[model samples]
Target: MTERETTYEAPQGEGRDRQPAGQASPAERSVGDSVFHRHERAVDEVPDQPAVIAPGEKYQLSSAGRRWRIGEIFKLLRKYEVWNDITPVRLRCLLEELGPIFVKMGQILANRSEILPQRFCDELRKLRTDVDPVPYTIVRDCLHAEYRRPLSEVFSWIDEEPLGSASLAQVHRARLVTGEDVAVKVQRPGAQQVMAQDIDIMRSIVRLASHFVQTDQFVDLHDVVEELWESFREETNFIMEARNLDDFYEFHLGTKGISCPRPYMKLCTEHVVVMDYVDGVSISDPDALIDAGYSLKQLGSRIVEDYSTQVLDDGFFHADPHAGNIIVKDGVVYFIDLGMVGRMSNHDRLIVKDIIYSVAEGDVPKLKDSLLRFAVSRGDSGALDHAAFLSDLDYIVADFAGLDLKDLDIGEFLTSLVNLARKNDVELPSVVTMFARGMVTLEGLLSEYMPHVNMIQIIRSHIANEKSTYKRLEDGARELSVESLRAARGTLEAAEHIGLATRMLTRGQLKVNTQIMGSEEVLRHVGGIVDRMSMSIVIAGLFIGSSVVYYAKIEPVIFGIPVIGFLGYASALILALGLGREIWRNGHARK
Candidate 1:
């Protein structure tokens, strides 16, 4: 019990590597000391600790519900003759017992069908976020406070009954005084508090779960939950949603094909967002849409073309494109709920294009290299799995080869690739997952309508266009070489100046009259002088090399013919001689 209690202390925030500028408090100092001692103790005698929970909470079934014990989670399968198949059914049952947050988490997990088994995602895909609507009084009060107006002045007709209620917010059909039809997305009062509490619990559970479940280590589950929390928090703020809607409107301005619901600025508030209601059949109901005189194939193509343009061309996209969030009215696709959108930096956008082009051309090594470089630079360490990652890519390319262009499950493949990367400990860049989820949902919606549309061929054409753009980018990079050279020269000069200044400043030595100091102290001081001399030599060589590389752009062998190359070699030798002299003088004086 004592040992368990001791192990339960929270992990220190990764020591000096992660510490911010602020001075450490006494408590923090103690924690750092303890961490160092504990690490040393482990080296002497490794203790058996509970399993690791990678990125999320450390959930014990007991915390949520005593009906199931941690032991029972595994034991029930054995006792109930269900041990042979722990498939999606067992998972769904567990999530149901765990409650709403877990259900929503499961649904998010479901979207990553590639990383998770199809059976599991299929089962969790059924998990919905519909909760009982809060009382109309609570909703009205929230609306009043958020908008700072009486409910009467805001809408000509506001329905008390919610169109849909979820964990975060509820949607109600309403009309503005201007007579524009709209959906009033109202936040439930205190949802932020509820979500924060739930997330705290989830985080705790994820921390502990990682210890017991090896899979938890594959994904940064804690980071995933934290990101989800931030996403949902933004969803609660109607102002951000309004901004997202506006961003989308501007994003699709030149194009006639893509459209997002127009937010009524006057009617929108922190708690309530009023947008032109999309009065169309849901994307999920393809047959109904087809019957409504819409060409399913055309609709599918439009979805692909529009979304591809948003992600690839504009670099901003709706992260969630579930059928519920998209509607088709008169063949025009209307996007609703712009709470979660993905934004890619120009660099990442280029990397994504590279990935797309590589995937289209079936360039394995290029794809692998691009993915690894991107992952290493853009993602955290725990988020990448190098070997399994490559294997998954291989399988994805090989598995989906012979399908008709339109019938190809591009979304599934991408999602699976992301999930594979995630599961193998590669933390996917947020934009990549956003693209993956958006593409998957778009593809899924499209496939329902256009059974024969060749998505692969379409994407291939898009990739060709992207390649042209990439060439332009390459030319721009070449243009930047001049700027890069100037920057490199400035940096080298600054380093040289700093080195000279430090040397001048430290030329005078402090003589401590400590009679008790022995031969070991002398040796330590001599060793420190040697180390500094060695570092000076390395820095001097680097400075000379930088000058040669930046200005001359020439590789220098000792036997190089040119003046600058020979100068670089001579400069390096002089620095080495100076360092050797310093070492000799310092070492002799110490002796």
Candidate 2:
């Protein structure tokens, strides 16, 4: 659901290259990132570090997962070796050659222009996920393998050419014997195996990179990659995707202004899927949509409501709602590629609804408590600085606070809140992050359709309508009564305990007991300090010892330096720097 600029004029596009800071690009205006980039300079000739793979020692690099043999590596490298210069385009080409996993990574990077250099993002955007379709004969073999019959028995006329080709599969237009036009998705031969091997290669890279990088934070590199792998696994399962499509299609069958394609469960298998053929227009193309005589405002309103209902009301949402995954068909928005979806329990949906209501009401303390409820806390959560949290929330909500009700943006507020949550010891599910990002993409998608629609007003209207629903009224009353009874029972128990304590004090029958307990918090702090000190001393000793060894001019010298001594010195240098930084942070905190 991450946003990527499709064309030059869309809200989130290459306008960063031309727009000044005062007159920001539509993307930066919509969302702010501190490290955002501008591809203002000519970039085709800009030099970049070529990604090289030197086959290292077997024990460290050549594990069971890394099946990249020496010959295969060299062959892949040679394809891009034009005068030994590996340009960004060549890098993208190499990723394509490597496999679909790498291409998926490239597509992800193409959207992170803020984190990555603009030149790299531009070239990686050209990394094609859609490749040449597998031969028709091979496709026929796959279909036959799935059905154990000749293709002629099912399809009256299957086009020799694929209608669309993607990383894992290709779609072919066909007519079933029943005279129904259908799209058949055939998995590429050995696509699963290739992706598995690529994931192995990625794991090795992450392992090596973590040693030299500070990768510990709210997100872990390995976990992130594994999550991506899980997503890919879901997408590769055609049967699961067919089920998802069916669920969505059924959910919105009678809904106006939007729909999902129908899936044929009978024709689905692990490798192939049959669904209704939708010859649709890219939602990114505004002129065509306008020429079709569809009101952009009406379409945009429907799109926003569809997603809000999925997330806030239904709690079952399309996790990836980027422009490419959506299409315009006969004045209705048709959603495709239902491999990845997000679902929340009724309780989670209630918490999210409360959060939105809190924001709308400008109740910062209530919002903080509602958000903190989802966060995991130890003994010190009550000790959380309420003032600090309130300040942060106020800053986050400033855009919408005291605004003309018609101009507020609930999506931006949600995105900001999610990003702010991670740094403050607030633990949230990945699906929440995905939902927030999907909202951001939804905004960019609808900007072309309707520039003036206020999402906050829509959210408010939805909540008001929900409050008046009979089901909600019954639920609210039941919950309130239950909570009140629990509170009263707890109060009576506390009064009884106090009466017993008073009686014991009057009779002098309560024995006084006292013991000093070491605080786990303080002990942990001291232990961390001692650990840093020990590491610092060890690193210093290593540096001094290595210096002595080097001065003695010992054996195994390389480039006029002892190899072992050089290694020790490098290790000590990194550790000493880290120690210094840690000390500085602690000292600064004390001040």
Candidate 3:
């Protein structure tokens, strides 16, 4: 059998009682006790079931349950008087009381200072995900169920006290049987089930609220829910986290001054992850680093430099780089918690490069183009007001013109640019937003370490150093060649069209079609004028005929007037009065 198959399967001829091949042992059975597993089993039992279900269906909550949860949420909102006045502290408190999903949402929003006020972002940043630790016995039982072999075969020792506990999982330091120290991250039992239910509830609330509220004016409720769901999915799947660690480890191979934990793939599963244990000072505690004889400025500079490399060169970066996720050991910075990361394609990276370069050079048009290229348009492109967008961009660029790198705030600048894009009906990708938030978090860390260190300057320097002059020249030449070919093709197409038109003209078969803009409205006005003129002519005829008839009176008369003439006169007066009122109303409307 293959190595992967062996890793998950029970060993053959073991001394312990063995089930038939492909049958799960008691330990394996116990591992499937979570609701997520039960749901999977239930689905598997069904015949001809599709591979996937809608999010609402997959994360099902009964009608009554959903209503009750929504009621609780509304009550909390009312209690805080969120509609009338929502302070930063009150918002934070509401999120905390709402539960983990809401707290996660607040944490994400905390990074979006461009959308929220800085004070609100600051208050949200203060949100702590530390929850009460799961009992040690439960942790042990979970680990035992995950391992096919006995616990003693894998870990020599595991600390009863958790190293740290968070909303999703808790970490504990353990020593492997191979005498290497490792950190084991165990998922809380039924954590995924609870998170899934909460997400479903959130979706329901957003959907219900959307009917009576125009929330899209401020934020995309559906997008926020999806983003939260995506984050939750990644953060809960320890297997994906293990893979991320492996990839990041490979990325940092032979690199210096920066590292990530090396995951033990054999020991990792959906519910558990075992990786190299980092025993280092958390970057959050600057005092300890200073006591450890580390230069804070150098550390901060290194972080910014390494992060730039991760983003621009590697394209994969740690999405959440809060101080807690970073540690310093012997001057080496270790980025941990690979649950969340961001990625940019080569095309996106180039556009980002152009955006940064254009901003630095104060090229407003170029900046606008790069931003538009990076943004995803929600409406008709033709409907976009490019001139107005450019004007706004010009204002933003002017604010940053001639500013020294050290004085520039990268996070604030990115936020402004994103906000401008949003205001102009353009949306940047979620990864870009994620990167912006990561930068803001990084900047916050730098403030504590060394306030003067400029992240943008570091990024600029890194970009310059990343490519040689010859390489850049080659890239420029390639781009020029591509553009030249496009231009030549366009010229040829124009010539062909002209030749056809000339031949048609020589043959006396040429025709031209013209259309005036706003012709529909013009035609409607013309029709109205004609109707009014026709009515006036009829009115004049009626008055003239009635006068003639009255003067010629040769038939029965009523009070010295012919009956037909009298009726005509009455009709003409009524018509004239009606026409006059319409004319007067139209004249007043114009005014």
Candidate 4:
């Protein structure tokens, strides 16, 4: 409602923004036209233009995007490379300068096959969240704004330089007035607004891509963007992350040597998070960990086992456990950054357990069966060559067959297996993919930390724990209980039916007619009579209403005639034609 704000309504057909008259919109041109007509109608409403910055010119500040201008950003990128690269390199560069929302969007875009080219994705995968820190004055100002007090009153001393900088927030080391050292994560000013705007852009991107691309086999592109939006919202809210840390710590409480950061939640807010400061070498640095007398092999196994417990045992696990998010100090592993987490239900956990079991056991037939059963889409089971798939799966797990753990790359192996599954028209869940990616990330860190670490043994041990005899017995008992109830109910129902049949036969009152709808003709005429009578009355009303309106000359006329009267006449005409068509169809049926 503000005069300063701008809105862009999509131009209808024949408008400048519409596609050329003969050209079909995305829905009309989609591979599966039978997908849905409503989808086509919706897609046709969008302006036939992508908002991406075009080559050889600065980005156009469209009405919807006019709130923020990036002419300076585009100018800076033009220094290293021209605008015509047709690569995501420039886009990635621009996103880095634009801040957190753009950075998150770039990260999400890496997986969007429908909207982004693979090459662009390849370049974007290299994008990192190592942004520059704001000045100490800004941090001080933020603290003042949040607490409504001076920084000196809250903190005894705070570091001017940030410990590390990321897309949404930057971390700083500080000491509380009470003398406890803590890490302060300060959210960028106006970050929520920027994130909201970028999510709106992402929605537009996904909707546009859905019109033309086929991403239905695994995940819906729009749904993925929506998930990312929700994730962004959670990540931005520091209070939510504090709760995650607390919950994760509670889940692993009393477990030997495994830990997550403890939050001082009273001092936390939507914009700032304060947690106990932890001093440890990054897990990626194996030399430091080894020099500090920590066992790399033990660390690797313990971490994987912990995640395994989180996934199968607890049904909740950190989704993002990259090397950067993990730390090792004095033989203890600490998981950090609890923004993105994944949760599974008991049923999903069972499916994952079977998957891990089959893969670790290297049982090709069992693996194939589990994959087919667990996949989100089991496409054309009959069309799949089960023997060939099993053979291929055997080759895929050939590395896992032996216990030479150092040479085996578990992450790559799992990815290949999932890729093979996809090729065979088996689509797995998002959690499955996330789990594999997390494993791959851990594998890289483990390999770097301890080249000879036997992760296979650890993973197998944890999986064995998941597939314990007690769990099997419990599951069997549960199934048996349900089956017994169902069978008992069936027996009782059968006896009742038998008793009724006996009474009917004894009384000589049993009657049966095998033919379905024996009275179809009479019912059909009766229904037809009712339908025609209603249609006739409605049509007559329409005609009479139109005549009355035309004679009365109602106000707000269209083309020298009342619009309502014209609509009434059009409705009557349509109904009469429909009636005539129905009669003709019925006559043909009779003939």
Candidate 5:
């Protein structure tokens, strides 16, 4: 066999095992504990970070929150007369009153400009990231602890006045001793403690809301909070942020024309990042670029292309692509805030590319499967109504045409999509929402400058190129065969699982009366798999036999039909019919 063919078979032997080959017994430590340990280590390494007082805080919260029972909450709402505002204003006000966790929630909701109703999102977007900047003394002390040196020794001059202050960190302009102008980002003192408390509050909110509210038509609050926690945790790690900066800079390969602030390796710490700062006019001021002798259309088009390439091409993106994050400096777009980024594995990237391609081609079935793959986490056992998903997809895809892609309200589509999934109890990946958010933001940015640009055409071209590249890599027959074998192995494992179900049923492991319907569904699914596999085997057998016969110069007829041609066709059809009949009967009988 050729090297490619030999390499293809390398994974074939191991593919049958769902776990790694020669699986070991489960370790005493769980993955959750390992993750927690890492978090603890990171926290311990940060100097002068305040200890979290969970018990005291919990007591205070329980005592305070008890006053706002269901009746009281409703009474307050009525007294404020805020029930008439469907504009998300009332919700914003509530979040403000609830404290930092709710503020963080508002930020996350704002990021989902696509998945949220525009009016609601528009209102929530107004929730500023501004918080009380940590006292200058606290900031100085934290910096001193991080560097273990006098602040003046490194920086010739440091601005006490912050350029901007957000909930987590604040930025200040400074000059290094070597005369390099830079920006220093200092984490707020006791920030980690604040985050822990805020997270606890968020968890409590989700728990309470899930128990009391009618949000079955949207994402379950608990799961959304879990996703939010992961996002926030990832963002809070400065090491991760440093890596994000480096990774995107390397991935972009300089053609992106966007600049990342270079991290000063020696000066960086868990709570502080010193980096070269680029001065620019904010993207929010559309007129500023024009006055600076730059074409708005050119700038907007570049933003769209850069974002498309990052997502569809590189599979890593700045999850937050809002205008405030983009700065026009020396005619180049500078991407700031490296904390939040999204990364997709190659497999995920290919699947997403297929999804985008299917959407562009108006392939309803393919689009539905792609969306399911995009939404449903691996090993999810929940019932997904593929037919219903396809129906909704048909409406969206059909409507996507005719309108200028830039003008198409993706925000509206995502709201509908999220609603549909929520209604069916389908859990979508938070990263997918992040993707949608980034794309929507890019489109919104483009609209500010190049209003007439056809975004659909732009996205279509990007997807086409991505698909072409994928096809090129997958064109090798050996690679194709390997993928086929891997798929077969997966099918076989599923079959074994079905056999286990049968064994469990025989052993009375299942609750007979309560599980009758579920059992029937499982049987139908297994039977369908069996039928398809049988048909495939038979068809392959006939084709191979017929090919051998033709090669051997066999007789022209077989049972009064032309040998190898008509007989093979007839045999294949019979096999398909048998399988189809078996599948149909199994479904009917099970029901």
Candidate 6:
């Protein structure tokens, strides 16, 4: 089998010149010149001196100072006509210049074509965190600090050349003194601190931007930032990743055709991880895999089946299963990079199964119920229009009904479902979004290997085969029992409340307060109508009284009319004209 290629390749410069240790590579220099060089002077103006302040104070000061400096530099650039219109390339370059946190943000946005344009998403997909490898001295220092031992005590031979280098960490090939080949992943020095600081800055920026930007139309920016921090925290913790690897290894112990790296727990720490060195051909290289006597179709099917089991049955899954993260050795598929994983609760897993089953059966009502159960209401659940939500689901179901199993795109379907939920004022859990992105990525990787593989069909079949009729009936009975008990409890509570209310009413102690939305305006409008009606009644009474006075001759006559009748007639005329003028004014105001 062909050995797996290096995880990242440094961009080649003109003539492919090499750089010495502790210096920037040609690629890094070019990037800095384009983005940072222009604003170097402005950035230098900010004092970098340490101060005696509280932890929170220090963080606030640092984040605020950085934000202000960035804003100033951007303003200066714009004023000087040094910046151009932001295109896809410029945006990616800017994110790179902004640092790893922003680069991760851009990468996340790359998969979100529903929110961004296709071209932008395509361009962002090219975003890579590959930088010059950390110097060997720094790498040695990190290992010594983590292990607290001499190099000879652990590894007999360690390669200075990095297998891969990313923003968060770098991996190198090594052999243990015990004669075992292993891979050493060292977390970059100060990576955690920089990430924490950048995350704070990101939160501050998002909070400030929320005032002028409406992100409810898409995903919440605040949630996005928080999720980014959570992911960063998980990915940077090497111990956690080692634990994940152990769990995954155990889960697949007896399973065939799937494997993952086994970490050496004794050697793993927050700053470093050591695991088995996987020597295999990357699944991305189809020709090499074929040459190694592996059937592409079989590999794709096996991967899909295993992934389905990971999600639906195990409730734990490899969140990022891109081409680079997968490899093949002797017909066995290996999943590496256990740093980032997703987990779902049992309840969520069952709901997801129901969703898939409903879609397969073309049952719209069941699909709606499953989605609503899976979704979270941002506000009052009672406020949602069930009718409209059901209507939208019907349209989505109809659109999918016509597509054949092979023609169905599971990623697109899930995205549409998520978008519909968002439009109806409901939000799915973050895990669901992550799963959707993972599925899309996995599909893209398998598009060439297995064009006829239907993920939805496979999942549906898995669900069916996993549950027997007896099991299904047992589950139904359990659910029915729970719902029946809840209903009984609710009914009893209602009766007791009604009896209490009746007693209060008999004793004249019952009080009811009703609050209507927009009540102030409603009440004001009602009061105005009442005033107008009262004024009309008074004017009519005056007219009738005046006519009666004139007929009865109650006062001294003036020009064949009683004096009181004449005064009443004048008053009524003035009042009527005033009411007319007020009506006209109100009408014009409304218009």
Q: How many collisions per candidate?
A: 33, 0, 0, 1, 0, 0
lDDT of 6 by residue, 1-591 (tens): 211122112233311123335543332333323323322333345334312335563223354545554674475446544356667876777666556777888877776665667788778766778776766656765665555445667877777778888877889888888888899998776565556666877787788887788667323567668888989888888999999999889999998989998899999987789999988999878899889888888888899999998998888899888888899987789999888888999999989888877777789989988888887764445476677788899898888867888888888788788878877877788889888878877887887556766777787788878889999899999999999999999999999999999999999999999866446788999999999999999999999999999999986998889999999999999999999999999999999
Error of 1 at 154 (Å): 1.9
Predictions ranked by TM-score, top down? 3, 6, 2, 5, 1, 4
The lDDT values for all models are 0.66, 0.70, 0.79, 0.70, 0.65, 0.77
Instruction: Tell me how many residue pairs clash in candidate 4.
Output: 1
The digit string of per-residue lDDT tens for model 3 on 1-591 reads 553233222224332222222222222233325434544454557534523446765444466645566787788889999988789999999888776788989987876665578899899988877777766656666775566345777877777667998867889888888889899999877566556767988787778887788654335556678899999988888999999999899998878889998999999988899999989999888899889998888888899898988888889999888889999887789999989999888988888888889999999989988887887764546356677788998888888867888778788788788778877778889888888888888987787667767788789989888789999999999999999999999999999999999999999999999866446778988998998899899889999998999999947798999998988889989999999999899899989
Looking at candidate 4, the ten consecutive residues that score lowest on lDDT are 3-12
Per-candidate TM equals 0.61, 0.65, 0.76, 0.61, 0.64, 0.71
* Ranking of models by lDDT: 3, 6, 4, 2, 1, 5
For TM-score, the strongest prediction is: 3
> Which is the winner by lDDT between candidate 1 and candidate 4?
4
Instruction: Name the runs in model 3 displaced over 4 angstroms.
Output: 1-68, 71-84, 111-115, 376-383, 491-591
| Model 5 lDDT, residue 2, Cα | 57
Compared with the true structure, what per-residue lDDT tens digits does model 2 show for residues 155-187? 776665678777788888888878888999987
Point to the candidate with the largest lDDT: 3
Q: Per-residue lDDT tens digits of candidate 5, residues 1-591?
A: 453232112223333112321211111012223323444554567645633435554213333334333344466457556767544877777666444456767766765543467678778866657655544444555665565545557776666557887766888788887889889988755444445545666577667766666564234556657766787677666777877777777776567467677777677766678888888988788788789987777777677677777877788899877787889888778788888888876766777776656655778787767767776552246665566666777887787644565566654555555555555556667667777666666666666656766665666676666556657676656678998999999999999989988999999996545434326767978886886887799888887876667566566765654576667767877887877787799789979
Q: Please report the TM-score between candidate 6 and the true structure.
A: 0.71
Question: For model 5, what is the error of residue 149's alpha carbon versus the real structure, in angstroms, after optimal superposition?
Answer: 2.3
Candidate 4 per-residue C-alpha lDDT over 1-591 given as tens digits, one digit per residue, 9 for 90 to 100: 431112111223323122221222221123113222322343456435322224432212244442342343355457546446645777777667665666766665665544567788667756778755555545555665565444656777666567887766778888888889899998755455455655666677667776777666324456556666777877988998999888888998988888888899988987789998999999878778778888777787788888878877888888778788999766678999988877788888877767666766777787887777766766755456576678778887775666465566777676677667766667777777667666766666666666666666676677666557988799889999999999999999999999998999999988877844346678889999799889999999999999999999997797889999999999999999999899899989999
lDDT of 3 at 540: 92
Model 1 per-residue lDDT tens digits across residues 136-216? 545554564454434556566666667887766788787766678788888655454344555666677787787788664
User: How far off is residue 281 in model 2, in Å?
Assistant: 2.8
Supply the TM-score for candidate 2.
0.65
lDDT, residue 379, model 4: 74
